[model samples]
Target: MDDDALRAWSVSVRYPGQPEPALADVSLSIGPQALTVALGPSGCGKTTLLNVLAGFVPPSQGRVTLAGAPITGPGADRAVVFQHDALLPWLDVRDNVAFALELQGVGRRERHARAEALLAEVGLAHAARQPVWTLSGGMRQRVGIARALASPSRALLMDEPFGALDAFTREQMQTLLLEVWRHSGRRIFLITHDIEEALFLATELVLMSPGPGRIVERIEPGFSRRWLAGEPVRALKSDPAFIALREHLLDTLARHRQANDKETA
Candidate 1:
C-alpha cells in the first residue's frame, strides 16, 4: 500500500451564480498513515475541501485521486465521522458499530467480536448494550468513532467531530482519538475551526485562507508524537515550543481575518 495516497491537484469548486469559487487551486496529498488537519475560519472552504476529498462534492476544475485512481464519488475507501453523532437512535452501541461490518457480509459472531473490541478501544465497552439515546454526547461521539473504524476504509474523514462537546469532553475526546489513531495507523483527513485542536491532533496541519479558500501554510508539529511517546498531555501542551507555535498561528489567523475584512470593505 505504499502507493496508497489521496491526492487533489489544483482542485476548485464553484457553485451556481457564486462570484468566487469556494475552493481554489487546493492541492494536498494524504498518505496511508497521515493524520492531516485542515484549519481555517468559516467561509474559508475547509469543509468544501474535505467534502471534495471525501468525494461528496466534486471539484469544478482539476481532480482528486486515491492510489492514482480518480475519485468519482463517495466510496468505501473513506469513512466519514460527522460533527454530530450519526448513530442510529434505535440501535444499541454494539450493533451500531457492527452495522457496517454486517453489511460487508461478515458473520454475526465475528462482527460482534470486532465491534466489542472497537467499543473497548473507544472507551465504550460498558455502553455496548446501552441504547443510543441513553448515551451522553461524548459517548455517542465515541460510538461514531468506533463505527467509522469498523469500516474497511484506508482513511478516516472527520468534520469537527468534537465541535458539539463541552470543553472538558472535547479535550478528553481528542486524547482518545490520538490513542485510536496510534493503534489503527490509518490515514485521517480532519477539518476543524479550532486552532489548538488542530495543532494537538495533526501530524500535518494545513492552514487555509478565504476568498476562494486555499492553503496558506503547512506545519508539522511534534506534540502528537510526544504524547504518543509517553509525554503527559498537559505538560506537552504547556511546553514553551508549543505555546510559541500556538501564538504564531493565532497571529497568522488574525492577519488573515483582517485581510479578508478589508477585501470585503
Candidate 2:
C-alpha cells in the first residue's frame, strides 16, 4: 500500500484558557513502512501532536487521516508506545504483552505464544516472567515496545519512547528499535526532543516550534541504517549536520519565545 498520503493535517489543539493553542495548524506525512520522527524543543507540542494521532486527545480543528479515511477513535490498527512503559504493575512482561490480545478475547495459549515472540524481538524474553515494577527502566520500555508489536497495528506512534533510559541503555534501546522497525516495516510516528535520536532513527525529520506548535521544517536524514546507527551516531553526536539541525530548531524556539515576550511587553 502507498503510504505517501499518510499524514497529519491542519491539526490544532487548544486547552481551556491556555492563551494559545498547544498545537497550531500542524501538518506532516508518513510514507508507508517509513519511520518519521518529529524533532523539537520541549513543550513544542511533540507529544500533543502524537496524542492527536493516537486519538487520546481531540484536535480543536482539522482532522487526522490515514490513507483517505478519517480516524475518529483509537482502533486496533494503530498502537502507541509512550515515554513511560505504562505497563500494568500487576502483570509480568509476557502477560502485559498478551493483555491487548486478551481484550480482543484471544485465548490465553495463543496470546502467550505471540507475546513470547515479541518479547524476544525486543530482547526481553529472559525477563518475560518478571513483574513490570521489578524491571529496570530500560527493561520496562522494551516491554512497552513488545506489547505494541503484539498488536496487529499498521502504524506505531511513539512519544519519546526512550527518553527516560540511561545513556547506555538508551543506545541499546535505539538499536533494538531499529531492528524491530526493519522487520516490522510498519509506519511510525515518533516524537522526540533529542536531535540525534530523531536524525538517527527517522527516515524523515520534522522540527516543531513551541505552542501553538507548528511544524517548522522536515528533512530526510539521507543516511543508511548500516552506516549511521548505534555507535556511529554517537560518534557523530556533535557533527555539523546534527549541530545545524539543532541550531535551526533552537532558533525557531527562540523566535517563538521572543514573540511571546513581545506580546506580554
Candidate 3:
C-alpha cells in the first residue's frame, strides 16, 4: 500500500436549495496505517462526507485528493463497500468477487485465481462456487469485502458495512476486518452510529454533530492496535480504561446531540 493519505481539505457540501450546508469546512486525513471511523448521529453528514471522498459527490468548496492528485471523479484507487452487498445475483460468489478485475480486462484464469485467494483469506473459499443469493447476510458481506480487495485501491471507504448483521455476526466481522487490515495494510475509513463498534475498530475516530454537520472531536483510541498486538477482543473491550473512554465518547455525543436538538426545536 502507498504511504500517501486520502485527504479532504476544508471540504463543504451543500445540496441545492438546502438552507444549511450538509457539511461545513470538514477536513480529514485517512493515513495508510489508520482505521478511521466517522461516528455521528443521524443527519450529521457522515454519508455525505463519504460520498465526497469517494468522488460520488463533489464538494461545494475545498478539495479531496490521494497522493497529491485531485479526485475529480471515482477512481480505482479508492474502493467502497456499502452497507448492503451490491453483488450480482446472476454471478456466483467467485465471479462476483472477480467482477472488478473482469471489468479491468484481467484474463479469466488470472481473475479467478486472485478471487479464489481473496475468498480463502476471507474464509469463503468453500462458498466460491455457490450462488450469491444463497449466502446469508454476513456471508454476503464477506463476499463484498473480498470484492473490494479485488480492486487495486489504496484505501477502503466503507459506510456502515456491518450495520445489517446481527450483534454476534457484527462482532465477528469486526475481528475479521481487523485481520484483513493487518494483512492487507490498507487504510480503512468507516462510518457508523454504533459507539462500541467505533471505539473497538477505529485507530482514529472523528465525531461529528448536525445542524450544518461538522467534526466535534477527534480521537486516537488504540484498541484496534491492541487487538492487532494479540490482545483478546473481549478482554480489551471490557477493560476499565476502554469502558471509561467509551463512556466519555458517549457523553460527548449526547451533549452535541442535545445542543443540536435544541437548535432545531
Per-residue lDDT of candidate 3, residues 82-195 (tens digit): 988799999999999999999999999999999999999999989999998899999999999999999999999999999999999999999999999998889999999999
Candidates ranked by TM-score: 3, 1, 2
Better of 2 and 3 by lDDT: 3
Q: For candidate 1, write residues 221-257 as lDDT tens digits.
A: 8688888899988898888988888899999989988
RMSD of 1: 1.3
> Which residue window of length 10 is worst by lDDT in model 2?
222-231
- Report clash pairs, candidate 3: none
Q: Which 10-residue window in model 3 sums to the lowest lDDT? A: 1-10
Model 1 has an lDDT value of 0.91
Model 1 has a clash total of 0
- TM-score for candidate 2, residues paired by index: 0.89
Can you tell me which runs of candidate 3 are displaced by over 4 Å?
Answer: 1-3
For model 2, residues 163-239, the per-residue Cα lDDT tens digits are 98777888788778878887887888888887667777778888887746888787887443644344465555566
Task: Per model, state how many residue pairs clash.
Answer: 0, 0, 0
lDDT of each: 0.91, 0.81, 0.94
The TM-score values for the models, in the order shown, are 0.97, 0.89, 0.98
